[model samples]
Target: MASSTVNRWLRPEVYPLFAAVGVAVGICGFQLVRNICTNPEVRVTKENRAAGVLDNFDEGEKYSQHFVRRFVRNKSPEIMPSINSFFSDPKL
Candidate 1:
């Protein structure tokens, strides 16, 4: 009589626990996929390849220096104020 009562109390509860865990796992998987699909910056549509352009070139340092010199702008010379515009100058 006691064995029958024990089985009856535990049998239905185990199925509900399994169902709850399954639902939790499904929800987590759905959220993970949704986040990955929403982000756009990391997409790679280009046919990217290893930079195999320099296999023939040995003087890479000269090319690098030339590119840097072209990219950088030189600072302008400081302006001096005339006698009339002396009040406009910050140095005054």
Candidate 2:
């Protein structure tokens, strides 16, 4: 009886969990692409690594990116131009 119940779950009911996992993986992939596209430094680092120029990841003064810290520090300068244009521009 226990084996039968486990089998039932292992067949059809397990699919929803699999679907949810697939969706989650897809979302994560999209977020990774979005991050690469938005951060020029990160994108450059990735390219360097791919090209083998950045062979030793631990070789220097290089440190992990703290996106939140950098984003917070740079937010005002980053946002002001876009915000100004957003308000100034008229819609077609």
Winning candidate number (TM-score): 2
Candidate 1: tens digits of C-alpha lDDT, residues 1-92: 99998787668768898788889999999767744553232233343234333343444444444544765546333354365367765783
Worst 10 residues of 1 by lDDT: 39-48
Which pairs of residues collide in candidate 2?
Answer: none
Candidate 2's TM-score? 0.35
* TM-scores of the candidates in the order shown: 0.31, 0.35
Q: Mark the 10 consecutive residues where model 2 has the least summed lDDT.
A: 54-63
User: Residue 51 of model 2: what lDDT?
Assistant: 66
- Model 2, range 1-92, lDDT digits (tens) per residue? 99998887789768999899999999999878866765334535655657643445553223344555565765665448888979889978
Candidate 2 error regions (>4 Å): 1-10, 45-92
Q: Judged by lDDT, which candidate is best?
A: 2
| lDDT for residue 45 in candidate 2, whole number 0-100 | 62
